[model samples]
Target: MTMSTKRPFTKDIILLDNVEEVTNKIIQKLQQDVLHNLKRLGAVVGTSGGIDSSVCLALTAKAFGPEKVLGIIMPEKDSNQDSEMLAKELAATFKVRTIKEDITSALAGFRCYERRDDAVRRVFPEYDPMTYKMKIGIKQTGLSNNLPPVFSLTIIDNKGNQEDKILPVKEYLAIVAASNFKQRSRMSMLYFHAEALHYAVVGTPNKHEQEQGFFVKYGDGGADVMPIGNLYKTQVYQLAKYLGVPKGIIERTPTTDTYSAEQTQEEFFFQLPYGLMDIYWYGFENGYSAEEVAGVMEESTDQVKALFSNFERKKRTTDYLRMSPVRDYYGS
Candidate 1:
């Protein structure tokens, strides 16, 4: 809750001063959570070569030793090649065993592409899955605007020609439902490895994803332990550096990597860059006034207030993603 005096209310407000101390505490807790609490002998992590997963892999290696950790690199047809390359680098760097599972065929069996494309074709009749790569992104309305978020579907042809359309609700829901199979399938694969080896699954969602409902339920959201669930994205990068994660991965832009066409996490869901989002989120959560945050961020007070409102709306609407299954009993 303390802010650095050097620049009060600035981005420095969220900087982790004692990164080593913070990381060591996480390591200690992860050991206790997995070994003692879950009665697991080892850890299973699905590495995406992203900062969150890389950090989780490193922490698991430290907690259970490299020999006791298994990193599963699950890639589908739409995944970036860089994701696989970086994941392998991370495993080699951490000295952990890794298994590569290509889920493209599995997704094929589930008709993931078929179902998703069926919806896309409704919007663009000429859309051909084989000739076009597609992605969904929130229209950038600037975080300071009070307008509701709008989602658009974009398809890029082989020639790099792009076309975008305002996604209809029915098509949007159908597309999302199909895309969720990817996460849920990955979760199943992770649990399979975990159960087979008597290892607990370590989830990689950071605070933003976990809190803002940016994850799939029982999918990426399912895990025995989420070591960095409490850490902000900025803090996750801090741990990444202290833990010696690969520099290429450290510098790589955070992405969803769920679509065939490349898309960043910011464009897909979060509208602001992580650094600015982290600062605003910290200020909002800590009860700092919009006027104070605006002064530091160099934005109008109304804009800051609007961003805060948007944050509240997002949390309220996505609260279901953070819930336990309801079990109300009338008899009781």
Candidate 2:
């Protein structure tokens, strides 16, 4: 098999020039958002051993000396052990102050797993929570997949066996509620440190996740400043390389890091890989026809249109997540 080269459509989105200049602008923005807007001494970033957070942390450290930034590792029982270790490793390399807050017990009061499991048992009666992990996903219909994805639940047994079944609406709601607690819990921890140190909480989402509504509202979505939110995932990687982020982090795959069953961002939300998805979103935003983009990306027109349709579907479904809580007409 032969490897594919960069596609022409990348010109519409990927920023290939003046990476240093762009990096400087983001650095200034982070400083301005924290020191000026929030009047905070520094910024607090929850590092997940992923490139987005790693790059965000590096930028924050550069903006306000490494001593000022705080890196918090908030892992729970389902969190990957390597994530915590890598987060610490990134902190040490950047010379940023670090702290660990295991939130498994704190989230216990929420009955996260129990409620989720209760719903799971409705289908898989013999599913043992202790010995297995569960993940929810959508069934991809076809290239021209105009219809909404059929959501399904998947369970992985300890012996590495796997099972997939259609998810009831109640089960989907329960699982999502339980998983979201993890993000909200981490956000709470970050605020605790930020409040204590008079620092701003820095969000790590890239343009794709930010614009596509991929983040959980009032959870990972809550932040004083999103340092990398304006950059596409590919551009974020460009900065990552330019900023000398840890090689391990720069190369690690982007994951939801939300579920115990191990799922990628593409699997959970975006159907395409971040690199490809970024350009597609850009193309869609700029009003490029799917057939036009398909020709450049070497994909079938139907596939490109399908992805575009899916993007629109997600945006509509998640629009509510982007809103502030409702109040009285007087803005109470």
Candidate 3:
């Protein structure tokens, strides 16, 4: 796994040469962690019709029998219709049992939409939930620029007329706190099924999500075992293909799907496309110099360095998300 400075640094550097082996290793670890460690009868996965969840569901089915795996499709009012469709398709493909739990009512009860919209209206006085869709995304800070990321709020009216504004910190925090309810609600549903069925909840976060802190701490981040946590986004796609995931899902662009207005994972959080980000991240993690990466990426050295710096900043800031509860004093 030595990185050669003289040799070309291509995307191939991250490609898994032994896809089958990698898949089997994950299946084995999952079985061990769930059946032995967690003492669970089977595995429960929250499927979003996305690549990560699809691959997780497939691995769960393979690790335990298909009958032992339960795919819970949790959708809310803001969720994409295609997410449910693809999630169902994924379960069917693997012969895993699935149950749909629409959390729209639950979210309403929790005032999820109302609270989020209330914050949106603070920024856009004319915002009306009935007539408008809203989303928040990070403004591109230019990976090479070493600038703090800024978030922008967007409201789209019925006619697709759109307005954008810089999100004040207060509104941004309020909006995020409210939107997180969707994930927290979905997590509650997954745990209920897991407990009832005596199955362990399997997480679907990839290396980027886990390391870069793109996931909600106790929401999507709550799981007994994470099989793909170590694999990069590109590697997850590799596993999806190896596992025969549906073409539609494999080809689907990654999205936030948490917002009503359409937004991509890139625009919402990760600034660059997964392909470029993956390579740069790999270089950064493996101690590759900026000049070396720049030579390979054909970008300026300072630009590569800035991207690396950004990665470091994200990890540092999100480190708290990955920590266990602080317990300084135990009874002696």
Candidate 4:
């Protein structure tokens, strides 16, 4: 019953100290693994015109050749065309086949689930959409132990101090819900493509997010093998440049573009830029205590500890990352 005090970020944080070498190693290894693991395999990538996907596309194309890599771009109705454009550009740049799938139809279906009839049934059902929707707009802050100081990150770096301005949390969640659904839908498409081609779904999430457990369960984190899961954001940029990722894709502030993410990805993490974050988080990922990690980074002690303590949440993310259907266990 005792609460565990270990900082979560240290447990599974992928080290990116030697990013160029790490990325090359991961990409080469995965390519070889997939080549040997499955027959007639062709890799599939979901390209959102984001930095992560661009890097993945470039590397996958290089390793497997353009004919063997497919890029799928999933755009929600509200999403800007820029994302789609970037995905297509990267696909062309890498000479990969491109598919565009709009997810507005699916979101409508997921939202339209009816709760018809019986009052008792309407009142309670374990799998009700209403119940799941209730997960939205609730006072569920601090649910995860990671305590990433997301607010502090925002307020600290935002020059105008606009981070404290009241944000529509409910609306934000709804928007994110729709956007995440689009991601999951696109991922489903990616997996199906992989299945047809007998190839692996190449994962693009990097090391820092893995440590912070920053992904939806059975969602974005799932992949056959994460080619860039070992790289840090700081390092990913360099590799992107090395691999010839377009300047626009590399320079555009990192964002899920979920819920109109005006703030860059770093801003959401309390304005802690990746370069600055990597310096200390690198330590945490390498088993340095929060105090020790913070000490070198010159960040406040409590905030840094909060980031480290997110171990349980990180563990859950790792579960999702490692989880998949067991073909052997199913007696195929």
Q: Give me the candidate number with maximum lDDT.
A: 1
Worst 10 residues of 4 by lDDT: 112-121
Count of backbone collisions in candidate 2: 0
Candidate 3 matches the true fold with a TM-score of: 0.97
For each candidate, give its TM-score against the true structure.
0.96, 0.93, 0.97, 0.69
* Tens-place lDDT digits, model 4, residues 27-60: 7786677787754376888888999989988888
lDDT against true structure, model 3: 0.92
TM-score, candidate 2, is 0.93
Better of 1 and 2 by TM-score: 1
Ranking by lDDT: 1, 3, 2, 4
- Model 2 C-alpha lDDT per residue in residues 110-215, reported as the tens digit of each score: 8877777888888798788899898887676522577776678999999999999988888888888878888898899999999999999998888777777888
Clashing residue pairs, backbone N/CA/C < 3 A, model 1: none
User: What TM-score does candidate 1 reach?
Assistant: 0.96
lDDT of model 4, residue 144: 30
- Write candidate 1's Cα lDDT for 105-124 as tens digits: 99999999999999999999
